[model samples]
Target: MTWRLFRFFLFQLAGASLGRFLFRGSSPTQGAILGLLAASALWVLIDLRRGARLLLWLKRGETAVPARVDGLWGEVADRTWRLIRAREQKAADSEARLQEFLAAIQASPNGVILLDKNNRIEWCNETAAVHFGFDPKKDVMQHVGNLLRDPHFAGYLAGDDFLHEIVIIGPRSTASRPVRLAVHLHRYGEGRKLLLSRDVTALEQAETMRRDFVANVSHEIRTPLTVLTGFVETLQTLPLDDEERARYLALMARQAERMQTLVNDLLTLSRLEGSPPPGSSEWVSVRALLTLCEQEGRALSVLLTDGSGKKHDLRVEDAADEEIAGSQAELLSAMSNLLNNAVRYTPAGGRIEVRWQTLPDGRAEFSVKDSGPGIAPGHIPRLTERFYRVDSSRSRETGGTGLGLAIVKHVTQRHGAELRIESQPGQGSRFSIVFPAGRVRPLQPV
Candidate 1:
């Protein structure tokens, strides 16, 4: 402004001096035209200066002036600020929701893992850590293949057939009660994947047990039914002597008895499993229980005895006359089964020892150890299973129902007792039932 004003003033002064010197008789019209020209130039200079200042202020991060009147620039600025604030608020909300989702997944029981396009682990929940024996923090970004080296899992990942899921045994399956894992993988979002794992160990075991139980029951029933059918057919189709007929009838009767016993045992197991737990009830004397068992054992001995008196040897060892609070009938049955099994399996001249003793810890152990052909180590664990027999031929010959041990097991469990089986092939087996101290009762004075 100042420089332009000074230039104009200097020009006007020069013009006036020249007009006076060159045209002393000039008219006032020329003076008026010069003054108008100077004023127009000054206005142009002032406008130019204003524009330069506005540009400089804008470059220096100052607010720009309104391009138009009627508050248009103000409206633009307000809308831009509001848009930025709304976008920032939306981003914060999204982050919060993502955190909540992650927390929910972390609390889930099933294992969950997220994989990137390269098949590397991007994220995993804590349950996944427990399932796969992995460190959730350190294993991030590691290839799934490197951490899980199981051949089956490796194949699953590499295989193109991913429409279906697979079930495999997880880590610590053998020792830690056998955990079964159902793994499912899904493709998502441009080559990314999600892997979900669930523990189905209990479900799988229950299914297997149900199938086995059904199959076993069928097989057990069919064996006797087959014999009965054969005998009936013979009786109907052929004329037989009285002695042969009697023998056949006896065979049929034995088979029928065997089938009945198996059915009774199955029913007993079902009842035990479904019934309420045993309560503190009538007190039964262990001595009396043993006395009853001895009577039954002797009867069985007589049945199997040969004329030489060398077929069965039964020995009864009386420990303290301890009493236990439980169902007397169940206890008697448990004791009688053990004694009978011992007598039946022990060879001629082989002794069977039955003991009812009180341990120092106040627990009572009713043990029936026999010199019979001992069970193998593998068979001992499953000896209590229904219809499980070490020697099917011998079991039939001895009138063994193959459910005696199973009954004992159920009875002991109902009474809070422990059944310990010690056996080795060719060394004879020892079957003992240990009743905890809590179940033991003080004996009444005779």
Candidate 2:
């Protein structure tokens, strides 16, 4: 400030000298007045030039700090530069945060979409793009309704009701591998909206399975219970001969046994689902398992033949002396189920071969091959489903509760084994459980 004052006074002095020289014959008072006027005009002009430079620098939006100027103009330029730098840094931080937030949304399993006031898509996560079958780049600014043509979703968007979520088949859904989505919209930010979608196909299928399981169990138990009740009533109300009584008692016992088998299978399945997977610490001998299966299989085959002198060509070939790791009871149950299924399904006098062999890959395979009527291709995939049967009547005649394959499947999965089924209609069926090398090892000497 002092320097500015000094320079201003010096300019005035110079202007007075010049005025004196120019007006040498004029009066001193008039010359001094003109000199002061000249100095004031020169000061104004210098200030204007600095202001013009400051204005030009601002217009250019240059990041470089302005050079020092005199008086209030220097202070004004410095303050302006500081404000601009702060604003730029704030804008950069905001951009970085926005990118971080978008990245988090992209990694989410569920779909998220941002829509403008006009219902056009502003942004969407990768999951949303996949769910809606959209190109993330190309689909921006496109109307949501125009891209998703589902009538249900269109109606949902049009309606004012947003309290409840609507289920819709996603754009990528197909008949075989259907994709179900639960979608809802939340109004936000002045008429704009957030669209949230989650894949619910697995949940829907599980619910359907639960319903079917309950219905099937009720039917299975009720049928046998009804028969047993009828038999009991007959024995109590009517005077029956000894032979009739014995036959009725026998039939009732069979029904009771059938129900017991069904209950036991249901328990096994529950336990398999609830318990941790079987580990490799406990091992069961393959030879022992086959021995038990052979005894049960022969008995079941004899019972199915009903003493008509019909017998199966039952063969047990144990080429692998490996020990399978798991619960002994579970292993036995799984192997027995496969063997029993073979005996039940194979016609009398058909060939049935049970083999335990070690593959070249060090995996041990327990296989049951039967020359009975092979399952159709369509039925093979669903054979392991609970209570699913190719011929329900035939299965009943064979005294099967229809839970054998399901139990086998659960046991194999628990033991880290793969259940492979090969069958062609009218040819034969081969059911194999291949145990991983980690679970199978050469038998240790006792």
Candidate 3:
């Protein structure tokens, strides 16, 4: 400031000295005063020129300071440049953070969408796009309600009630393949909204399975209990001959055994779900498993025929002398279940073949091919579901617990194996468990 003032006064002094000499005819004081005013005006013009340069630099948004500009304007330009750089850096950082947040949302399993104040599509992640079949590029700024087109969701949005979520069928949903989404909306900035969605088809199916399981269990237990109750009441209320009493007792025992089998199957399924997977440290012999399964299958066949000698043409072929690496008890139970199911389902004199074969690809497969009435295409997929029956009456008549295939599936998964079912109506059914090469090994060094 002192230097600026000194320069101003020096200009005025130079102007006064020049005026005193040049205008000697006039009074020196008057001449000097006139020169001072002129110098001051010239200084103001130069200052304005520098200020104009700074304004131009700012208008151009240049980072570099204007050349040849000095004094207060220079400092102003430099400080302004620094401030601009800082602001630019802060904006860039915010953009990066926004991108990172969007990336995280994209990777999320659930769907997310950002809606504008007018409920238009502002932004959405890939999951949301997939959930709603949205084309992000084309859908931007489009009205969300128009795209959704669900009357329930439109009403939900209109109602101004965001306390709960709603489920809607996805665009790709079909009768054969179902897609259910759980969606919720929350109010955000300035009348904007955040829509979140999750694929709840699996959860819905699980809940359904749970309800069906409870109902089936009650019905299964009730049927046997009813028969047992009737038998007990008859024994208590009437006097009967020894043969009649013996027959009634035998029938009662059969019903009790059926209930016991159902309970055991349920317990097996629970244990498979609760326990850790069976390890490969314990080896079970394939031949031994086949032998046990054969014995049980034939015995079950005989029982089904009521000792009438119209047994199935059952064959248990151990073509490969392989060892399956897993719990022996579980392997035995699984193998026995498959074989017994074939025997029970196949009619008397039908052909039932069990074989342990090694696939061409170093994998071992245990298969049961039954020449019974084969299952329909629709029923094959859900055969492993608990209590799922193609023919409930026939399943009951065969004394099936309806949990055999479910147990098989669990056991196969635990052993790192795949349970495959191939069947067509009247062409017979083939159920196979393919063991991975890691789980199937031949006897080592005799």
Q: TM-score, each model?
A: 0.72, 0.90, 0.91
lDDT for 160 (candidate 1): 78
- Give residue 187's error in model 3 in angstroms: 2.3
* Pairwise TM-score winner, candidates 1 and 2: 2
Worst ten-residue run, lDDT, model 1? 64-73
- Residues 1-446, candidate 2, lDDT per residue (tens digit)? 78878988888998887777677786776787788789889988999988888888888878666646666688889888888889899999999999999899999999999999999999999899989998889999999999999999999999999999999998888887999999999999999999999999999999999999999999999999999999999999999999999999999999999999889989989998899987788988888889998999999998998776789999999666778889998899999999999998898999999999888998888999999999999898899998999999998878888888999999998888999999998999999999898998888998
| Candidate 3 residue-wise lDDT, 78-151, digit = tens | 77788888888899999999999989989999999999999999999889999999998899999999999888
RMSD of each: 10.4, 2.8, 2.7
- Runs off by more than 4 Å, candidate 3: 11-42, 64-68
Give the candidate number with the greatest lDDT: 2
The lDDT for every candidate, in the order shown, is: 0.82, 0.91, 0.89
Worst lDDT window (10 residues) for model 3? 60-69
- Checking candidate 2 for backbone clashes, the offending pairs are none
Give the residue spans of candidate 2 off by over 4 A: 1-49, 64-71
* Better by lDDT, candidate 2 or 1: 2
